[model samples]
Target: MKPIVVTGGTGSLGRRVVRELLDAGREVVVLSRRARPVADGSRFVSVDLRTGDGLDQALTGVDTVVHCASTLTGGDEQAARTLIDAAKRAGVTHLVYISIVGIDRIPLPYYRTKLAVERQLEASGLGYTILRATQFHELVQHIFSLLGRSPIVPVPTMRFQPVDTRDVAGRLAELALGEPAGRVPDFGGPEVRDAKSLARAYLTATGRRRLLVPVRVPGRIMAGFRRGENLVGDRFDGEWTFEQFLAEHATRRPSRFTDAGGSGG
Candidate 1:
C-alpha cells in the first residue's frame, strides 16, 4: 500500500499522528520544509509548502495525506491550494485536515484563513475529511506559563475546552486509516473551563502561585470566545482531562506546545 503523507509531522500534534499511524502499521511519510529524522518506520521528505518545492516528488505514489501543517500568519490558503493541486496531480484519494473549532464565529484573521482552506479542500474534488478539535492541553499550559510569569496573571475573560493531543491524534490516525468522512463530529475536552480557572489549575499543577485576574477586553474576538463559539457543548470525545495531563508532566514548556494546524488551539 502507498504511504500516507503527513505535513508538519515534526510538530507536537503531527508527531503523535505520525506515531499513531505507524502503530497502526500503515506506511507513512513526513513532509516538511526541512529534512528531519522521523520515527524509524516513517520517511521524512523535505518540501516547502509555501513555494511548493519538492511537494510533487514527495507525494508521488501517495494516496492519503494528513494535513497537520498550518500557520497563524498569512499564506495558509495559498499553501493549501498548492498542496491540493499537487494532490490532484498525484491522484491522491483522501486528504485529512485538522482544523480548529469556531473559525466561522471568530473574526480572527488566522481563523478566517483556516476556514478558507477548508472551503478550498472541499472544492478540490478529492476525497477529504476535516477534524475540528478544541484547544490542546499543552497549549493551555503554555498560555498559563506565559501569564503566570508575573505575580498577577491577568487572563482573558473567556472560556475554552482543552483536549489532549493524543486523543486528537488517535482519532486522526483512525480517520486516515478509514475511508474519507467529511467534517466528522467535533472533538472536545472533558469539561469546559474558564481561562481564569485554567490559569489557577496551571499554577497549582506547576507548583506556582499567582493572583488570577480576569480582564474583559472589548473586541469581537474576545466576544467570540466569551460566547463559547470555540467550545463543543455536551459532546466530549476526549478521554483525558486537564488535571490528568498536568499530573503526567513535571514541567510544561512552550517548546512542548504547538499552534500548528488546528491543534494549536
Candidate 2:
C-alpha cells in the first residue's frame, strides 16, 4: 500500500484513524498546521489548510488522503478547495472526507460549510468518499459539560445520535483501504437520545445534581434537530453506545459538587 496522508491528523478522529492505519502496517503520514511529536513509525508533516502552506510537500508521494480537518468557526470551504487542488496535483488516488450527518437538512452554519465542501469534492473530478457521521461522544460530552455547569442547565430540546470516535475512525480507515464509494450511507450511534435525557444521564453518572431545563430553540436548525434530522434511525451502525462511553470517561470529569449540594454550580 502507498503512503496515506491524514489531514488534521492531530485531531480526535484523525489521530485515531492514523493509529488504526499504522496498526494495520500501513505507511502513514500526518498533516498538521504545526510540528507534532509522532512515534510508532508515523511521519508528521506541517501543513496549514487555511493558508495552503506546506500542502504540496505534505501530499507528495501520497496515494490516499483522508481529510478530517474541519473548522466549526469558519473557512471549511476554502480549506476543502485547497486540499482538492493539492491532491489533484499530487496525483492522489483516493480522497476521503469526514462529514456530519444531517448536513443537508440542518441549517446550521457549520453544516452549510460541510455541504459546500461535499459539492466541491464531487465536482473536483477526484475519486472520493464522503462518510457522514453523527456527533462524536466526546463532542456531546463537551456540550453537556458547558451546559451542566449551571444549576439549571439549559439544554436544547433536540435529539442526537452520538457515535464513538473510535468507531468512526475504524470506518474511515476501512474506507481508505478500499476504493472510493462517493457518498456512503450515514453512520450513527447505537441509540437515539434527547438533550434533556442525555443531560440527566450525564449528571447522574458524574454525580452532579443539576435541573435540566429544556429550551425549545426556534429556527430551522433547531427545528431540524427536533425532527430527528440529526439521527439516522435505521442506520445505527456504530457498535459503541453513549452509556458505554460515559462509563469509560465520565469518572475523569467528576462534578465539583456532591450530593450534599442539591443544584450544582
Candidate 3:
C-alpha cells in the first residue's frame, strides 16, 4: 500500500482519518506545523502551510494527499497553491480535500475561504475528491462555549444536521483509496434538529439548566444558517444524532447551574 499523507493530522478529523487509514494497513505520514506522535503508526513531519515552508519535504514520495489543513481567518488561497504545487511536483496520485457543507451559501469569512479552496482544488488538474460535510458535533459544543454563560441559550434560528467526525474520516479514507470523483455527495448527520433544541439538549446532558432562545441575526450569514444552508443534500446519509452524542458524554461530568439573569456560564 502506498503511504497516505494527511495534512493537519493533529486536528480532530484529521487524526481520525489517519487512524482509519492505518487500520486498513496503509502507511501514514502526518504533515503539520508541529511534530506530534499519533497512535496509528503514523510518522510526523513539521511543515507550516502559511509560509509554504517544508512542504516539499513533506510531499516527497507521498502517494495520496488528504488535505485537512485550513485557516479560518485568512490565507486560504496561498495555502492551497502551496499544497497543490507540492503535490503536483511530487507526482501525487490523488488529492482528497475535506470541506464544509453549504460554504457557498454562507457569508462568513471562514466559509468564503472554504469556497475558494474548493475552486482551487477543482482547477488544480490533479485527480481530486472534495468532501463537503456538515458541522461536526464537537463544533456545536465549541460554539456553545464561545457564546459564554447565559440564562437563555440564544441560538441562531436554523436547522443543523451535525455528523460525527469519525464518520467523516471514514468517508475521506475511502475516497483517498479510490479514484477521485470531483465533488462527492454531501455527508450529514442522521437527524435534523433546530439550533436552539440542540443547545438545550447539550445543556440537559451536561446537567445545566437553561432556556433556549432562538434569535435572528441581521446578516446574510445568519440568514443562511436560518435557511439551513449548512445542511447537506436531502438524500445524504449518516447515522449520528445530537441526542446520541449527548448521551455518550452526559454521564462524564456534573451539570453546572447558572441563573437566567445574565449570559450563560
Instruction: Give residue 144's lDDT in candidate 1 (0 to 100).
Output: 82
Candidate 3 on 1-265: residue-level lDDT in tens? Answer: 6789999999988999999999989999898887777755899988888787888887888779999987666787898898998899999979999999989988888888899999998888999999999999988877775553665667777788889888899999999999988999989888787776677667767777665566778888888888888997584566777778778755433555552423331
- Pairs clashing in candidate 3? 149-263, 149-264, 149-265, 150-263, 150-264
What ordering of candidates by lDDT runs from best to worst? 1, 2, 3
lDDT of 1 by residue, 1-265 (tens): 7899999998889989999999998999998876666888899988889899999999999999999998676778889999999999999999999999999999988899999999998898999999999999988988887877777677898898999999999999999999999999899988998887777667777777666666888999989999999999878899898989999974743322222212111
Per-model CA lDDT versus the true structure = 0.87, 0.87, 0.82
Clash pairs detected, candidate 1: 259-264
Cα TM-score per model = 0.92, 0.93, 0.91
How far is each candidate from the true structure, as Cα RMSD in Å? 5.9, 3.1, 3.3
Please tell me which predicted candidate would have the highest TM-score against the true structure. 2
Instruction: Give model 1 RMSD, 1 decimal.
Output: 5.9
Query: Which wins on lDDT, candidate 1 or candidate 3?
Result: 1
List runs of model 2 lying over 4 Å from the truth: 251-265
* Model 2 per-residue lDDT tens digits across residues 93-122: 799999999989988888989999999999
Cα lDDT for residue 98, candidate 3: 93
Q: Residue 120 in model 1: shift from native, Å?
A: 0.3
